[model samples]
Target chain A: MSNGAVILQNISKSYKTVKALTEINVSIAKGELFGFIGPDGAGKTTLFRILTTLLNPDSGTATVEGFDTVKNYKSIRNIAGYMPGRFSLYQDLTVEENLSFFASIYNTTIEENYHLIADIYKHIEPFKHRKAGKLSGGMKQKLALSCALIHKPEVLFLDEPTTGVDAVSRMEFWEMLKKLRSQGITILVSTPYMDEAALCDRVALMQNGHVMTIDTPNAIINAFPVKIYAVRSNRMFHLLNDLQSIPETEAVYRFGDVVHYLSHSKTFDPLSITRHLDSLSHTEITVNQSVPTIEDSFMLYMRKSDKFNISQHDN
Target chain B: MTTERPKVIEVKHLVKKFGNFVANDNLTFDVKQGEIFGFLGANGAGKTTAIKILCGLQSPTSGEIKVAGFDVYRQTNLIKRNIGYMSQKFSLYEDLSVSQNFEFYGGIYGLSRKQIKERTSYFLEKLELTNEANKILKEIPLGWKQKLAFSVAILHHPKIVFLDEPTGGVDPVTRRQFWEMIYEAANEGITIFVTTHYMDEAEYCERVSIMVDGRIEALDTPAMLKQQYGASSMNEVFLRLARAQSAEQ
Candidate 1:
């Protein structure tokens, strides 16, 4: 418990027959920018609710800032700032009003913590008189972040902050998170985007109520056990099936314009794949070794865990 | 080969303004038959506005537009019949069962009882959701719901389909599978107009148009755009264009 700013010891929760979380154990260090990377139904929201003291876990215990979530719920609420996935600000309230309202809730004034949200609030300042509901998607996200930081909480939890945001705005939002982290704020953010995993200091790749793996983005990519090759041809539609028919091919899936092919035998020759496709009348074929991305690592981990779960069911 | 295909969607100097704000400004493009066209832009960049006009959901302020050979201004009902739309936010009813939702959408599209029944069974088997037909939609996984929504959108055999961030929060494997489904549909001569925030998905499109501040800044093949921008990936190219817009403001 003393090792990190936030710690969970075998936290598990269930909603009726649905197991939203199972034996989730993670320790986030103080001032670390941690990411929970997963798709919907992965129990990210459930885990966040437990950490923020909004819901009690069915079993096990969790701690934030040396306080038990259940026993010290009030303290956790004071020190932790949470931005839910959905927009929670008052729709009729202007941007300035929302920020000041949030500040008042924490017994602080916006002027007292203006520096904390200055970089982000400035983006929405031009539209300070505009109603929150009238703001654009990107502007709404910034205002939400500003309100969440107006109270100057030590730990910030951003749940799917960039879920529906565009690529440009998503990039800009991440830059704000990086800047906040430099101020020694412990940030715990969750997102379903695999590409954003690379931007975090560390990430937990989760699926089906389980954390598949937790490590630095580079570490996870480097630890991929198999080599991958990018294969493309003029007929990409048929290239997927053709690559899978090869005896050495273990997995084949389309990645952008190319098909990522993994072989059962690592020492397999690349020329053999090209020759096979060539015989199948595929023209302008290019097969080259490619580095595995975080998305690739995530897919591989999900497959492994799925097989493990199936074998357990068999037993 | 692609040039030989007929145009399914054509826009000439399209413009849509809300009071003083211009949501879409002088947009012009053509979507060829069976082509998968990607519409990309930053938030508040007029993509939704342009899409609304193209789908006949809203009247354009001024422009010449044809969707599936139907005029946007005069033949809105005909345009609606020839196009299918699916979005991540609102595609299926939560309380309805899997088959019930299909039946409802099929009915809305004016399919006969027999056609609805046959197509419902066909798609359920294709998605391996035959057993889950009686199960409620909210009970299924998000990935399955997305796939089912896509299948239902095309049940009426519309000539063109518009997808708005269809795979926004889906897992990587499921996302790829959805793209494969898109490919299969396009092979059958369905013109697909898709908008996605994923730059990698942008690379999968036959061609893409990036909008900046209610106007198109770049329109070309992903390969050509990357080469022109001197960037390694579509993500870099987007950042260069979108960032340039913000820097000027």
Candidate 2:
């Protein structure tokens, strides 16, 4: 446990009748880039709050860099840098002023840790004189990241830094994170984007206040229980209904241009799918064995979890 | 011979300037009736400015534009009446009940009480939320709220519906379901003008236009764009265009 830079032991939190997190357990090692991959209301924010010492969990304990979140909150706060989901900086203050203010609160000067944020800061350097509110969305994100690193904390927690950002900017933000990781900082980030899960060293797929699976992105995809076929035809719109009608079909969902069809049996043949679509008067029908992505795994896990919840209700 | 569909959205030499900043510059495009047209761009790329103009929420400095066959400048009210809009930031009233939110939006669109009651029940049943109709809006899950918001947006049965990042943070299953709803609406001849950051959703559109630094850099079908850019997916096409703009600066 001492080797873990951040550790949570059976953490559980609830808001009135709603269970935000239930029996969550995770351990993030030092200098490792970890991701909490889930959608809204998946308890990502609540888990982050518990780790950052902002909220007390109803059960269990968490530690950041060997400091207990509850008993040693003062020390934990000093070594933990957190960027909330929303932009929480002062709107009236200029970008430069905001950075300096954050540094001052930690009893440190921006110059003392200038190298820590030098890469990200350069992107927003030209807009230092502008008010924080006047900056664009991408620029605001860069500035927020720079402020979080200005104090050079031992661990960083970023909550959905690229939630609404464009594809190009998101790519750039992940690059920044990799650079930070190379400098030996333990980083824990959360995102609703499944594609981003692949970029992390390891990810915990969460849903409904539970951790469905935890592993590297490749392992998670390889562990998918059933085979998935990418099916497409001339009539793309009708493909969903036609595929679902097939007796072997277990689940069907659209992925970009093709409809990803899962079978109830693991030994399902791609030829059968093509034959089914061909009989429906569909032309240019293509059925290919596709690789399961993190998204595919996430959806499968979510379905299993839903069935489990339903069975639990029955009992 | 098949008849050609009429153009529902037309923009020629559009321009909007705020002081020295040119938010939209010389944009021109046409959308056919019942087409799912995607408007995509990076942050601060002027997508919002152009959408505001089309939605009749803001006046363009100089543009010859028509939405739903109404002039953008002179017939703003008429255009507003013919279109529905929903954004991620503002969609429904969380303080009200699920049915109440529908009633309020329906009333604002000038529907009769009887029409509101009938449509509310109809949609609630379709969403399988008939039992939860009296639940508070804040109590429902985010995915349900989003689906409800979309249903409410089109309750007036407008000629066009504008969606701005409608599936931002929903689970993958619900996100796909939301797109199914969109497909159903489009099948009924309701024009869809949507903006999203998800490249997969961009591929779902009949045609997509990507903006970079206040200009439409590329506009074509997903397959055509991929071939033109020598990319395998829409995500590559977007990164190529947006990254080139930043590199130039």
DockQ of 2: 0.61
Q: Report lDDT (Cα) of residue A156, candidate 2.
A: 97
Query: Could you tell me the fnat of model 2?
Result: 0.81
Per-residue accuracy of model 2 over A1-315 as CA lDDT, tens digit each = 668999999999999998999998898899999999998888999999999999999999899988999999999889989999999899999999999999999999989999999999988998899999999888899999988888899999999999999999999999999999999999999999999999999999988789988898989988988888888899999999999888987889999888899999766777988888889999999888889999999888877767313111110
Q: Across residues A159-208, which tens digit of lDDT does each residue of candidate 1 receive?
A: 99999998888989999999999999999999999999999999999888
Summarize candidate 1's per-residue lDDT along B69-179 as a digit string, tens digits.
999999999999889999999899999999999999999999999999999999999888898899999888888888899999999989999999999988888888788
- Pull out the clashing pairs in model 2: none
For candidate 2, report its TM-score.
0.97
Interface RMSD of each: 4.3, 4.1
Each prediction's DockQ? Answer: 0.59, 0.61
Assess the local accuracy of residue B123 in candidate 2 as a C-alpha lDDT between 0 and 100.
Answer: 93
